[model samples]
Target chain A: MNLFIASLAFSVVTAATLSLAAVAFSLQFAVSNIFNLAFGAALTLSCYAAYFFFSIVGIEFWLAIGLAVLFSGLFAAGMSAFLVGPFIRRGASAFVLMIVTFSLGTIIDYGLDGGFRDNSFTLPFGGSSLAIHAGPFELSGAQLVVVALAVVMTAGLAALLHRTRLGIAIRAIVDNRMLAGASGVPTRKVTTVAWFVTGLVTGIAGLALAASTSTVNGAIGDNYLLLIIPAAMLGGLGSIWGAIAGSLVISLADNLWGVFVGTQYEVLIGLLVLMVVIMIRPGGLAGVISRGWGGT
Target chain B: MAYYISTLLVLFVSYAILGLGLNVQYGLGGVLNFGYYLFFAIGAYVGGITALGSDKGRVPALFQEIYAWNLPVHLPYPLTVLSAVVVAGVFSVGVGLIVLRSVRDDFGALMTFVVFLTMFTLIGAYANLFNGYIGISGVPSPVSNPELWYPILALGWLAISWLLVGAVTRSPYGRVLKSIRERPDAAAALGKNVRHYRLSVFILGNCMAALSGALLIGFIGAWSPLSWQEAETLVVFSIVIVGGRGNNLGVVLGAAVVGVGINEAVVFLPAVSSDPGLIPSVQWVLIGIITIGFLWVRPRGLLPERKAKWPWIDSKPGEVSEGNLLRKLRKGEARK
Candidate 1:
C-alpha cells in the first residue's frame, strides 16, 4: 500500500512538471501550426540561464527562476519573429516547417553545446524531505507543491485563455487567420505573445525538471523531447486540457511501470504505450471523447 | 602531407557514402530519417565484432555480445565489410518494422530520435554490450599497408559505390520513388506499392549507411558508441540538404564541401581546440544559419538536380512546360 501511494506521489510530481511543457507545446502548435522541435532547446537554454544566474551572479533560487523565465520568453519571441515567422510567410507547408524547426533545434543545441563547452551543472538546492498523509495517500511536501502548482497553472491558463481579450484574439487567429485578420485581430502580434508565454511555461518546466533531478545540461532538454511528443500526442495536438490529462495518464503509467518492472525498459514501455495509443486512438484520449482533434 | 590528404580523402569518401544514402531516403523517397546514425553505429559495431573474432571480453555486445566466433582465414577484408553491411541492414529492417507504421513526418523523426537515444543508453548502461563506453579498440585496419595502394583502394571502393548509387537512381524504380515523394496518395492511386517501395528504399539506404560505417571503422581501426552519435546523422542531413538532396552528384559535393571545410578549418581554429566548445558551437551555428539561408535563398541547392533531357530528340526547349523546372526550383528553395 505504501509503495503504491509512493508511486502515485511520484506520478503526480512527474505529471505536474510535464504539464507545463506539454501545455506550452500544444498551445504553440494550436496557434502557429508549427511543431517547434526547438521547443526543447528553448527549455534547455532557459535551464542554462537559471544555472548561470545562480552560479555566476549568486542569485537566490527565486531570482534565478525569474531570470530564466524572462530570458526564455524573450528568446522565444525573438525566434518566432525572426526565424519561424519568415518561413511561415514564405508559404512553407507543415512538413517543411517541421524540417525547418529541426534545423533550428540543431543550431540551438550545438550553439549551447559550444557556449557551455559540453559541461553539466547541478541545480543548487539541498533540503530534507517532508512527508504528509492525505487519507490513504502518503505524500511528500515536494509532491504536494507540484500538485498545487499544476492546479494553479492550469486554472490560471484556462482563465487567461477564456477571459482575456488577447486569449479570444489568439483563439480567433487559430480558427481562421484570414477571418481573424479581417475582424481586426493582430494575428502576428498574438502569435508573438503566444510564443513568449509558451517560452515562460517551458522555462518553468525546465527549472522544475532541473530541481527534481538536481542536474542541468543541454542534453536534458533533448531528453524531454521524446516525452513531450508522446504527451502531446496522447492529449491530442492543440488541445490544452487534453495535454494536462495526457500528462497525468502518461506519468501514472510510467510510475506504475517502474514499480512493476525495471526502469531500464521504461522508455520502451512508454514507446509501446504511444504505439498502441496511436494505433487504436489516433485522436488521443480526449480527442476520442470530444472529437475536436480534427481539421488542423 | 600525403598522410593528411589520405585522411581527408578517407573521411570525405565515408561521409559521401553516408550522404548518398540520406539523399535516397529524404531526397528521393521523402522519408525524414532523423535517426540515421543508429544504422551507421550498428554497422561499425558489427564490423568491429566480426573482425575481432570472438567475445573473450567481460561484456556482451549487440547481436551476440557473448557469441564465440572467429573470422576464418579465407574470409577477405572486403567480405567482412560486406558482412557488416548485411548485419546492419538486418538491424535496419527490424527498426523499420517497429517504427514504420502509419506515422506523421515529425512523429517519425521523434520516434527515430527516441530509438537512437534508447539504443545509445542501452549500450552505454549495459557494459556487457559493446563494451559500454570503453569501445572496441585495435580492430584491424582495412589496408595492411597504408602506402600508395591504400588510397587507390579506398578511392576505388568509393567509385564503385558511386556507380551502384548512380545506377539505382537512374532506374525506373528510382523514378517511382521520386514520384512517391511528390505525392504518395496520388502514386498509390496510380498503382504504386508505396509502403513496399519506401521500406525497400529505407533498407537499401541503410545498407549504404552500413557500408559507409564499415569503411569508417576500418580507417579509424576503432569503433565506439560516440562515433555514431545522432549529431552525425544531422550533419549528413545538412550536407544532403545543402548540396541538393535529390541530386546524387550534389550530395557528394555537399559532403565534400562540409567535410573539407570543417576538417581543414579546425586546423586553423586553435581556439576551438583550446576551448573545445568554441569550434563545435560555431559549426552548429553555421549549419543552422546556412540551412535557413539556403531555404530562403536557394532551396534547390548549389547544384540543383538537373533535368535529364535529350536535346536532339526533343528539339524544342521553349515548348517544354516549366512545371518540372518549377518543381525543381521549389525543391531547391526548400534547402534553406
Candidate 2:
C-alpha cells in the first residue's frame, strides 16, 4: 500500500509537468493549426536559459522561472514573426511548416549542444523537504507544490480563455480565421499572443520538469518530446481540458502499469495506451466525451 | 588520394542507399517514420554481433562477455549482411503493425521517436546487450585490399541499390505506392489494401536502410547505438526532402551534396578554437540551413525525377526497336 501510494504521488508530479507542456501544445495547435514539433526544443532552450541565469547571475529559483518564461515568450515571438510566419505567408502546408519547425529544433538542439558542451546540469531546488501525513497518504512539499501549480495554472488558463478579449479572438481564429479577420479581430496578433503564451508555458513546463527530475541534460527535451505529442494528441490537440485530462490518464496509466510491470516499461505502457486510444477513438477520450456532451 | 576518395566514395554510396530508402517511404509513401535510426541500429548490431561472434552464458559483468557465438570465418563476413536486412525488416514490420494503425502523421512520427528513445535507452543502460557505450568494435572490413577492393565493393553495392531503386520506381507497384501517397482514400476505395501496402513499402525501405547500415558499419569496422541517433534521421530526411522526395536521382544528388559534402568539410576542416563540440554543432547548423533553404526556395531539387513515360522513354517504342543488340545491352545497363 505504501509503495502504491508513493508511486501514485510520483505519477501526479509527472502529470503536473506533462500537463503544462500538453496544454501549451494543444493551445498552439488550436490557434495556429500547426502541430509545433519545435515546442519541445523551445522548452529545452528555456530550461537551459533558466539554468544559465541561475548559475551566472545568481538569481533566485523563482526569479529564474520568470526570466525563462520571458525569454521563451520572446523567442517564440521571434520565431513566429521570422521563421514560421514567412513560411505561412508563402502558403506552405501545415505539414511543411511543421518540418520547418523541426529544422529549427535541430538548430536549437545543436546550438545548445555546442554552447553547453553537451553536459547535463544539476539544478539544486533547495535542500529541504517537508513531509505531510494526510490520512494514509504522505506528500513531500515539492510534490505538493507541483500538484498545486498544476491546478492553479489549469484554472488560470480556463479563466483567461473564458474571460479575456484576446481569448475570444483566439477562439474565433481557431474556428475560422478569415471570418475572424473580417470581424475586425487581428488574427495575426492573436497568433503571436498564442505563440508567446505557448512559449511561456513551455518554459515553465521545462523548469518544472527539471525541478522534478533534479537533473537537466542536453537531451532533456529529446527524452520528453515523445510524451508531449501523445498527450496533446490524446487530449484532442485543440482542447485544453482535453490535454489536462489526457495528461492525467497517461500518468495514471503509466503509474498503474508500472506497479505491476516495473518503471522501465512505464513509457512502453503509456505508448500502448496511446495506441489503444487512437485506434478506438482518434479524437481522444476527452474529445469523444466533449463531442457527445455537445451533441446532446 | 585514392584511399581518401574511396572513403568518401563508400560513405556516399551508403548514405545514398539510406536516402533512397527514406525517400521511398516518406516521399513516395507519405509515411512519417521519424524513428528511422532504429532500423539502422538494428542492422548495425545484427551485422556486428553476427560477425563478432556470440557470447555464451559467461560471467555476469566483470567477466561478462554476453551471448558471443564464434562462427566460421566465411559465414561472418557476407552472410551477416543478409541477416541484418532480414532482422531489421522483420522489426520494421512488427513496429508498423503495432504503431501504424490509426494515428496522425505527427503522432506516428512521435511514436517512432519514442521507440528510438526507448530502444536507445535500453541499449545504453544494458551492458549485456552490445556492451553499452563501448560499442561493438573490430567487426571486420568487407574488402581485403584498401584501394582496389574497397571501390569494387562500393560500386558493387551501389549498382545493386540503384537497380533495386530503379525496379521499384519503374514498376506498376511503384505507381500504387505513389497513388497511396497522393490519395489514400481513392486507393482504398479502389480495392487497394492501404495498410498492407504501407507496411510492405515500409518493410522494404527499412531493409534498404538496414543494408546501408550494414555496409557502413563494415566499412568503419565498429558498431555503436550512438552511431544511429534520431538526429541523424533528420539529416537523411533533409536529403530526401531537399532532393525531391519521390525523385530517385534528386535524392542521390541531395545525399551526395548534404551527406558527403558537409560531412567531409567538417571532417577535414581545422577547428578555429579548441571547443570539440564546434564541429558537430556547425554541421548541424549547416544541415538546418540547407533544409530551410530547400523549404524556402527550390524544394523540387536540381534534378527531379522525370515523370515515368510509358514507352520507357520520351522516344517512341519503334525507334527503340531499331537499335541493335549492343545498343539494347547498353540501354539495359543504363537502366540497371
Candidate 3:
C-alpha cells in the first residue's frame, strides 16, 4: 500500500533519468543504423566535461549543462565522422561496427582513466540531503528537476521528430538511405546533424546521471552502458517512444527489485527483463528494431 | 631475472590455453564468445574450492568471516582440474540453450557479453557468495618451491592444452566445426544438427578455458574477482584477431604476443610515476590501441588463417552483380 506507492514514486524519478539516455541512444541507432557502442564513451566523456565546467571552471550549474552538451556533441560528431562513419560508409556489418564502437569507447575509457587516475569524483552540482515530502513519498529538488526536464524534453523531441523538416529528413534516412539520397534528402548532411544531436542528448543525459548517482568516474560510461543497452533493447533499440516507455518499465522493475530483493542483485533485474522480453518479443516492444531502415 | 622470465612464461602458457580454446570456437566454429572469461572464473573457484579441503580455509571479508565448509577429504590435483573443466562445460549447456535461441548471426556474441557483465556484478555485490569484494584467500597451493615447480606446472598444462586443441582441430569433428562456421545451411541441408554442433563446440572450448583457469589459481595459491575482468577477454579477442583467427599456431603466436610480449613484459618497465593508476591505465590504453590499430589497418591479422579447401571462400567470386559494382563505384565517387 504505502510501500508500493513509495516505490512507484521513487521509480518515476529513475525512469525520468533513464528515458533521457534511452531516447538519445535511440536517435544514434535510428540514423544510419549505427549501433554505436561508444555511446558509453560519449556519456562518460560528457559527465567528465560537466564536472570540469562546474568544479574547475567555476561555472554555474545550469550553464554547465549547456557547455557539456555543446562540447560532447561536437566530440561525438567528429568521432562519428572520422572514426565510425568511414566504417559504416564502407558497409561493415552491424556486428563489426558494434565492436568498432566498443573499441572506440575502450580507447576513451583508458585515456580518461590515465587522466583522472581512477578516482570516483563527486560533483557539487547536487548534494545528498533532506527532500521535500510530497504526499507519501519524498523527492529531492534535483529529482524534481530531472523529472520536469524529462517531460519537457520528451515533448520537445516528439515535436521535433513529427513536425520539423530536419526530423523528417533524419527519419527518411533511417527508412531508406539510398532511396532518400535518390529522392533529394541531402542524406549525408542530415545524418551528420542527427549524429551530432544524438551526441548532444547523450551529453545532457550523462550530466543528469552523474548528478543523480553517488560518484563519477572513468568507468561510469561502461557501467551505465550495461543498463542503457538493455533498456534501449527492451523498447526496441531504435524507437524513441519505445525507448522512453521501456525505460519506465525497466525503472519500475529495478526499483521494485531493489526494495524486495537484495540490493546487490539490482543489475540482474534488467537482465531478467531483457531476457523475458527477448523471449516474448524478439522484434522488441514497438516493432522489429533489428536494423530498421538500415539495410542488411 | 630468471624467475621473472619463468613467471612470464607461465602466464603466456596459461593465456595460450584460453586463446587456443577460443580459436577452436571462433576460428573453426565461427562462434563469437565475448563472455568467455566467465568460464575461467568458474574454473578458479570450483577447482580452488575442491582442493581447498574445507579444513584450513576461510573466506576473507571486511567485518567478519562468513562461512566455513564441512571438512571433506580433498580431491587430488588431477581430479580437481578435470572437475573444473566439467563444471564450466555444464555451465555452458545452460547458456547455449538460451543464447542460441535468442541470438542469431553476430548478436550472439553481445548476448554472451551481457551474461559476463551479469556474472561479474553478482560476484562483486553479494559478499556471501564469494565473500564480496575482498574475495577468498589462502586457497591452498599445489606444490612447493615456486621457481622450479611453476615452469613444470605451466609446461604441463600448456602441453595438455596444446595437444588437446591440436587433436580436436585435426580430427573430422574439427572439419565439421569448420564447415558449420562456413555454411550452417549447407551442413544442415546435409543433415548436420546445427544446434547440437554449436553447443557441443562451445562446451568443449569453455572446458579448456576453465582448465587454464584452474592451473592459474593453483600456481598463484589464491583466487579473487579482481584477477578476472571482461577487458581481459577483449585482449584475448585482440590476440586471435591479431594472430590469425582459428589457426592453432596463430593463437599460440597471439598468446605469446599479448600474454607475454605486452601484458607480462610490462612488469619490468621502470615506474615512470608512482601514481598507482598510471601503469594500469597505460596498459589498457596500449591494448586498446593495439586492438583498434589492428582492426583498422590489418583486420585479417598478421598470419591470416589459410583459406579452407571448401567452396565457401570462393562463392560468388566469379560473378559480380551490377548492384555490387554500382555500390563500389558509388563508394569511389563518394570518396572523390
Candidate 4:
C-alpha cells in the first residue's frame, strides 16, 4: 500500500508534465491540421537551449529557463511560418507533410547531436534532494513545482480558449478552416500564434521533464514521445481536456505497471495501451463523450 | 583497393534492394510504412541466428542465453536467406492486417512508427531475444572468398529484386496498385479490393527488405539492435524520394546517389575533430536537408513516372483514338 501511494504520487508528477506536452501537441494538430512530428524536436531544442544559456553562457537558472521557453515559442512560430506553411501551400498531401515534418525533426535532432557531441547533461535545478510530504504522498520540491506549473498552464490555456477572442478564433479554425476563413478569421496569423503558445507549453513540459529526470539528452524528447503520443492520442487528437484526462490514465498505468510488474517493460506496456487504443477506439475518450452514452 | 570497391558495391546493392522494396510500397501502392526497418531488423536477426546454429558454447557469454531455446538450426546459405524472407513476409501479413485497417493514412503510418519503437524497446530489454543490445556475432560466411564473391552474390540478389519489382510495375496488377494510390475510393468504386492490394504489397515489400537484411548480415557477419536503428528507414525513404517514386530506374539511381554516394563522400572530409560521431551526425543532417529540398524543388524526383500510353491507340497516326471518341460522344450527348 505504501508503494502504491508512492507510485501514485510519482504518477501525478508524470501526468502533469505529460499533459503539458500532449496538450501542446494536440493544439498544434488542432490549428494546422498537420501532425507536427517535429514537436518532439521542439521539446529537446528547448531543453538544450536552457543548457546553453545556463551552463555555457553562465546565465542564472530561472532566467535561462525563461529565455529558453521564449526561444522555443519563436522557433515553433518560425517553423510554422517558414517551413510548414510553404509545404502546405504547395499542395502537399497529409502523408507528404508528415514526411516533411519528420525530415525537419531529423535535421534538428542530428544538428543538436552534432553540436553537443555529448550524450547527456544535467540542469542546475538544485532541488532534487529537497523532499516535501503532503498527506500520504511525498514529492521532491522540483516535482511539486512541476505539478503546480502544469495546473497553472492548463488553467491559463482553458481561460484563453474559453474567454478570449484569440481562443475563439483558434476553435473556429479547428471546426472548419474554410468556414472560418469565410467568416473573416485571419486563419494563417491565428495559426502561427497558436503554434507559438503550444511551443511555449512544449518548452515548459521539456523543462519539467528534465527537472524530474535529472538529465537531458538528444533522445530525451524522442523517447518521451512514447508517452506523449499515446496520451494525446488517447485523449483524442485535438481536444485539450481529452489530452489531460488521457495523460492521467497513461501516467497512472505506467507507474502502476512499474510497481506491480517489472520496470523494464514499462515502455512496452505504454505502447501496448497505445496499440489497443488505436485498434478499438481511434476516436479516443473525447469521441466517446461527444457521442453520448449509447453512441458507438 | 579491390576489396574496398567490392565492399562499396555490396553496400550499394543491399540498399538498392531496400529502396526497391520501399518503392513498391510507398511509391506504387502509396502505403506509408515508417517502421520498414523493423522487418529488416527481423530479417537480420533471424538469418544470423539460423546461421549461428545451436552451439551455445561458441557464443559469447553475454548472448549464450539465446541458445537456451535450442531452436537455432544451421541451414545452408540459400535456405537461410529463404527463411528470412518467409519470416518477414508472415510477420508483415499479420501487422498489415491490423495497421491497414486504419481509416486515415497518417494514423496508419503513425501506428507503424509506434510498432517499430515497441519492437526496438522489447528487443533491447529482453536479453534472451536477439541477445539484447549486444546482438549476435561470428556467423560463418557462405563463400570462401567473400571479398571477391560476396559482391557478386549481393548483385545477383539485387538483380532478382529489380526484375521482380519491374515485372510487377509493368503488369495490370501494378496498374491497379497505382490506381489505389492515386484515388483509393475510386479504385474501390471500381470493385477493386484496395485493402487486399495494400496488404499484399506490404508483404511483398517487407520480404524484399528481409532479403536485403539477410544478404547484409551474411556479409557483415553481425546483427544487433545498433545495426537497425529506427532512423534507418528514413534513409530508404530518402532513396525512394530522391530517386523517383514509382520509377524503378530512378530508385536504383537514388540508391547509388543517396545511399552509396553520400555515405562514401563523407570519407573525403578532413577530420574536424577526434569525435567519431560528428561526421555521421552531419551526414544525417545533410540527408534530411536533401530530402526536404527534393520534396520542395522536384516533388516528382529526378526521374518522374512516365505517363502510361496505350500502344493500340498511339500506333496508328491520323486515327481517332477510342478514348477521345468516347469523350467526344459524351460531350455531344451532354449537349443534346
Best by TM-score: 4
Clashing pairs in 4: none
Candidates sorted on DockQ, descending: 4, 1, 3, 2
TM-score preference between candidates 2 and 4, better one? 4
- Which ranking of candidates, highest TM-score first? 4, 3, 1, 2
TM-score of candidate 2's A chain against the true A chain? 0.91
lDDT winner between 2 and 4, please give it. 4
RMSD of each: 4.8, 6.5, 5.7, 3.0
- Listing candidates in order, what is each one's chain A TM-score? 0.91, 0.91, 0.93, 0.94
lDDT of 1: 0.76
**lDDT tens digits, residue span B235-291, model 4:** 898999999999999999999999999999988887677687888888889999999
Q: For model 4, how many clashes?
A: 0
Q: Tell how far residue B295 is off in model 2, in angstroms.
A: 1.0
Q: For each candidate, what TM-score against the reference?
A: 0.89, 0.88, 0.89, 0.95
Per-model chain B TM-scores are: 0.85, 0.85, 0.85, 0.94
lDDT by residue (A1-296, candidate 2, tens digit) is 87777767777778898999999988877776676767778888988898888887789877887898899988988888788878887887655776788788888988888877537887776523676877666766776777788788888888778799988888888777888999999888888887887787888788778777777887788778667777776787678888887887778777777787776645565566667765777777556323211110
- lDDT of model 3, residue B166: 86
Q: Native contacts retained by model 3, as a fraction?
A: 0.48
- Local accuracy of candidate 4 as per-residue lDDT tens digits, A244-272: 99999999999998888968777776567
> What is candidate 2's DockQ?
0.42
What are the per-residue Cα lDDT tens digits for candidate 2 across B1-336? 887888888889888989989887887877878778778878888787676563433122432355343332334567889999999988998888866775455556556666777778767667676677777776667667856686678678878988998888778898899899878889999999988988888888899888888887777877776687667877887888778878888898988888998898887778857588889888997798889888888766666657655543335444645334345675785355
Q: Name the lDDT value of residue B290 in candidate 2.
A: 85
Docking class of 2: acceptable
Q: Which candidate do you rate higher for DockQ, 1 or 2?
A: 1
